[model samples]
Target: MQAWRVHRNGEPGEVMRFEETGRPVPGEGQVLLRVRAANVNFPDALLCRGQYQVRPPLPFTPGVEICGETPDGRRVLATAALPDGGFAEYAVADASALLPAPASLDDAEAAALHIGYQTGWFGLHRRARLQEGETLLVHAAAGGVGSAAVQLGKAAGATVIGVVSGPGKARTAAALGCDLVVDRRTEDIVTAVKDLTGGRGADVVYDPVGGDAYAKSVKCVAFEGRIVIVGFASGVVPAPALNHALVKNYSVLGLHWGLYAAKDPAAVLACHDELSRLVAKGVVEPLVSERVALSGAADAVQRVADGATTGRIAVLPAGAGAAR
Candidate 1:
């Protein structure tokens, strides 16, 4: 099997290398998957550089989410804390981690669905408890989790307002069913949310990009609104004042999707089933904007890290171009 491996902790492009390795064998209660496609995430780059919260040992593959199949021929999507060999022709995953992929979605889209969609779903539905008819604000609304949040927010019957960095990203957010798209580079996010919500402010703020975005989210959130902290993608993690939460009567909730998956597999399965049904029904679909070959794994990771790509980027192993 050919896989991209990080042999040392360093920059993405410098540490990651494509190499040949023997196919990984699955242990008991695990499945051997011929990886049809793998999704490149921001964490993949951070993982390669040993900057992510979870670090695998040296010479490990970085992809956390993948769509593939078990030895018994069941098509499934899987995620794990330990880095599996997802950036290759084959990988291994615990059978419990594998959820049946939606038959309606292609391999590329399936590969893209797990992490972002689950993160958004768990953040809004589980942590924030976002209600129907409420107004929701999504930061980094064109990125992977942001785009997913937009779609999920709409599906939950919320009036979704997306905040992006530029016009292109605004378009991407709009395509995902956001009612209003605000270009954060030019538009004031707080003012935009206020105006969009008729000065009531957003009922819920889904923030993946912390730092200024987090502070601004707090400012724009309505009384009794819930702000779900999903990730720190902006390279800065900000500590928002608790006094604001008290004064506004809102809550700042932290969502770690993997923890739920690890502690309560049944909840993970239930969420996956609901997400799969939504995908099959066309209510939610992964926007796989880029499809690259496995040999291009490093460049694909770079594209995500550099914020040059929109939606999801899938890495197709050799001879699997048509599958993507």
Candidate 2:
């Protein structure tokens, strides 16, 4: 078996080494999966740099989510258990946590659906309770996490405002069903949202890119609105302004989607069901921009970490069903 391993903490392209290795053995309550497609996530790079919240032991694989087939021939999506992640031809995951892959989506799309879409669903519907006809602002709206929120916001009937860095991303956001697209490089996000909402400001702000995006969201968020903090992708976690939040009467909600798997597993399953229905209806789809071969896993992770790509990148193992 061939897998990419991280021996030391550093940039993903520099630290990740592709090598021939023995297939991982599943532990008790775990199952070995033949990897079909592994989704590249920002956390993969954080894992390489030893900066993620959960640090696995040294010399670990970095992929977190995968579309794979079990020994019983069941196709499912699983959160790859650490140390032996989904970057190889085969990976292991807890049997209880595997989700049946949506029949409407291919392996790459199914792999891309788990984390990002679940986070977006929980952030918008559960935490913020975003309503129909409300103005929703999404930061980094062309990137993987933000793009999911954009599509979900539209499906929820919110007027979506997508804030992206460049023209290319702005166009992508527009195509993702955003009602309005703001390029942060050349436009003022606050003014754009305020203008689009007739000066009422955005009712909900989905922020995956913190730092500056967080700062600007506060300035334009509607009174008594909700701001969901999804992640700090900007590399700088911003200090919250409690006084401003109080004055504006808006709520600041922090979402960690992974916690639901333990605290409220049923909710996670229900969300997956809804996401699958949306996929079946073509109301939402994972924007898989690149399908890279197993050998390009390191570069894919680095590109995601650098914020140089739009939507999701799926790594297909050699001779796997989704590999082209």
Candidate 3:
């Protein structure tokens, strides 16, 4: 088996090494998956740098989510348990964590769907309770997580306002069915949302990029509106103005999607069912911009960490892409 391993804490490209390794055997409560595709995530980079909250032991693989198959050919999506991840030809995952992949999505798409779509679904529908016909504001609207939020926000019947850093992303946001797209490089978000809603402000803000976006969300949130904190993709974690929230009567909700996997696993399964229905209807699709070979994993992870890529990147094991 061939796998990419990071033997030290550093940038992904600086440390990740590809080599032939022995296949791993799954222990109790685990399932050994024949890898089809692995989703590249920001956490993969964080793990490489020893910055993520849960760090695997030294000399481990980095991919966090994968779409794989059981020996009997059951296609499923699962978390690539740390120290041994989905970057290899095979990986091990907790049996209970696996969810049947939707028939509509291929391996790469299925791999991309697990974390980003689940986070958007949980953040918007579960935590914020985003109502239909309300306004949704999504930051970093072209990136993987933000793109998922944009699609889910629209599927929920919200009038979405997508904020992107540049023209290319603004176009991507518009294609994702954002009713209005705001280029933060040029347009003012507060003014745009205020104008779009006739001064009522946005009903919900699905912000994955925190720093400046969080700051502006405070100024544009409507009374009793909800701002769901999905992540701090901008690398600057903002301290929200609680006073502002009180004055405006809006709520600040923090969502950690992984907690649902632990506290209420059934809810996570339920969300996957809903997302699958949307997938069947073509309402939600994981935008996979690149499908790299297993050997190309390091560069893919690096591109994501540098904010130089749009949509999800999947690492397909040898012949996996062609076989599909």
Candidate 4:
């Protein structure tokens, strides 16, 4: 087997080395999965840099999400157990956490679906309780996590306003069903959201990029509006002023989707069922912008870390032909 390994904490591209290695052996209650398609996420970069919440021992593979085939030929989606992640020919995962991959989606798209979509579903629908006809504001709306929130918001009948950095991402967000697209690089996000909602501001804000994005969100959030914080992709975590939230009568909620796997497994399963239903209805699809071979895994992670890519990037370890 072959995998990308990190020997030291540093930038992904600098530390991730591709080399030959033995296939990982599954532990008790774990199953071996033949990697079909591994999704490259921003966390892969963080893991390489030793900044992620869960840091495995050195020389571990970086991919956290994968679509793979079980020994009995069941195709499933899973979170790769650390120390032997999905950036290789084979990886191990807890058998109980495996999810049925939607038949309608290809291996790459299925691999891309789990974490990002689940985070969006839990953030917008569960935590924020976004209502129909409400105005939803999504930051980084063209990226993997934000794209899922944009589609889910639209599916829930909310008027979505997507905020992105450039003209290219603006077009992608518009195509993803955002009623209005705001280019934060050129336009003012707070002003745009206020104008779009007739000066009332947005009813719900889904923020994956914290720091400045969170700062602006509080300014335009409506009275009693909810802001769901999913991640700090900007590499800066914001210390929010609770007084602002109190005076404005708005709520700021934090969502860490991974904790649900252990805290409430049933809810995670239920969310997957709902996401699968949406997939069947064609209401939600993983926006996979690039499908690279396993050799490109390190570069993919680096690009995601630098915020240089849009949507999801899937790495097919067995090559593109491995995915149907």
Candidate 5:
């Protein structure tokens, strides 16, 4: 099988190489999948840099989520068991982790749905308890995970304020159902959000970018508001001032969606059901901005790592042309 592998810890473009490799054999409790489309996630770049939580031994494949086909011709979404990841033509996934691909989405879109959307669903509904008619603020609102939050927040009837880095992403966020879009590069996030919300501030803050973004959220968060920390996409992990949170009477919640898949699989399934319904209704659509062939997987991952992509990018590995 043809696959891309990282032989050393480095930037994805610097270390990832394509080569013919032996097909990965699945062991007990696992299923083998013929990769159809694999989404290039930021973690792929972190894995390449040896910066992610779980680093595979040297010479590993990095794709985490994929839409795959079984030998029986069933289409499913699966998490690539590291080392034998979805970057290849074939990969192994735990049978328990496989989900039926939503009929409404294409392979690339299905591949994008699992991680980003799941994170947003869990962060907004399960953690922050975002309420209908309330204002929700999303950071990095044009990126993969942030865009998912925008869609879900709107679907739940919340007025979403999306904070993006540029005009292009602000347009994308508006198209994704954000009631208001704030360009962070030129406008002040806290001020814009406050002005949009009539000075009450956001009732719920969905922060995927930590550094300055998190700090700014603190300034504009409403009283008794809940701030859900999804990730540190800004590459700086900021320590929250717990005293300020206490004095302000707001809550800060940390969300790691993967833990639900292990600790409470039922909750994960429930979230999937809701996401699937939204997909079927066309209420939530994964924004796949670019689709690259397997040959360009490494570069796409690098683009995501460099924060240069506004939406999802999927690698088509089955000889199908990548869609725009």
Candidate 6:
């Protein structure tokens, strides 16, 4: 099998090298998946640079999720711990980590599922408990997780307001069913949400971009609302203001989807099943923007790190073609 490996912590373009390796054999309770597609994630870059929360030992592959088929022919989306080798053509995964992929989605879309949608679903349904007809705000609204949040928020019956950086992203967000799109570069999120919500504020804020967005999200949250902190994509983590939380009576919830997947596999499977139903009903669709060859994995990862891609980018395994 040809796999992309990183021997040391550095930029992915400089560190990731494609090489032939022995095919892996699944141990007891594990399955050897013929990887059809794997999605590039922000953490893939961090893992390459040894900057992510979990660090693998030297010389490892760094894909966290994948969509593939088990040896017995079951199609599934699988999430793995650090040292995730989904960048390879075939990788070994524990059977417990596998969730059946919806038959309605193709391989690229299935690969795109485990991370973004799962994170969005957990944030909106579990953490925020977003109520029907409540106003929801999503930051970075064209990126993988952001776009997913927009779609899922609508499916959950929330009126979504998306915040993006430019016009193109605004259109992309709108296409995902956001009720309104705010260009953060020129508009004030607090004021926009206030106007859209009739001077009240957003009932739930799904923020993956921290830093300035976090502070502003606090300002726009309705009284007794919930703000779900999903990620720090803006490159900075914001400190929570307890005083503001107290005065507004809003709750700040941290959503770590990976932890939930690790601690409770059953819950993860249940969420996947729900997402599958949404996909079947066309209520949620995976936005796969790019499909690249396995050898182009480094470039794909770089595109995600540079913030040049709108939706998910999936890498086809060695000999695998684009998903039909």
C-alpha lDDT values of all predictions: 0.85, 0.94, 0.90, 0.92, 0.90, 0.87
Cand. 4 TM to true fold: 0.98
* TM-scores of the models, in the order given: 0.96, 0.99, 0.97, 0.98, 0.97, 0.96
Q: How close to the true structure is residue 305 of candidate 4, measured as C-alpha lDDT?
A: 94
lDDT against true structure, model 2: 0.94
Instruction: Provide C-alpha RMSD values for all models, in order.
Output: 1.4, 1.1, 1.2, 1.0, 1.5, 1.4
Clashes of each: 0, 0, 0, 0, 0, 0
Per-residue lDDT for 24-131 in model 2, tens only?
999999999999999999999989999999999989998999999999998899999989999999999988889999987899999988999999999999999999
**Residue range with the least summed lDDT across 10 consecutive positions in model 6:** 315-324
lDDT (10s digit) by residue, model 6, range 1-324: 788889988888989999888877777878888888888888898899888888988788877778887878888888754364789888778887788887778888988878899999999998899889999999988999899999999998999999998889888998889999999999988999999889889999999889999999988899899999988888899989798899989999999898886698888889988998999898989998888889899999987887778889888986653345
On lDDT, the stronger of 2 and 6 is 2
State model 4's lDDT.
0.92
For model 5, the local distance difference test gives 0.90
Model 6 clashes, total count: 0
User: Tens digit of lDDT per residue, candidate 4, span 96-213?
Assistant: 9999999989998998789999999999988999999999999999999999999999999999999999999999999999999999999999999998899999999999999999
Which one wins by TM-score: 2 or 5? 2
Runs in model 4 lying further than 4 Å from the true structure: 319-324
lDDT of 1 by residue, 1-324 (tens): 798889998777888889988887778887778888888888888898788888788878877778886778777888743556588888888887788877778888987789899999999998888899999999988888898999999999999999888888888988888999999889898898998888999998998889999989888899899999888887898977888789999999998887887699898888888998898778998988888899999998887887777889998887663443
Q: What 10-residue stretch in candidate 3 is worst by lDDT? A: 315-324
lDDT of 5 by residue, 1-324 (tens): 899999999999999999999998999988889999999888888899998888899788889999998989888888899888999899889899888888878899988889999999999998999889999999989999999999999999999999998788889998888888898889988888888888999999999889999999999999999999988877899998899998999999999888898999889888888999999888999999998889999899999988889889989885742332
lDDT of 4 at 263: 95
Model 2 misplaced stretches (Cα beyond 4 Å): none
Estimate the TM-score for candidate 6: 0.96
lDDT, residue 136, model 5: 96
Error of 5 at 173 (Å): 0.9
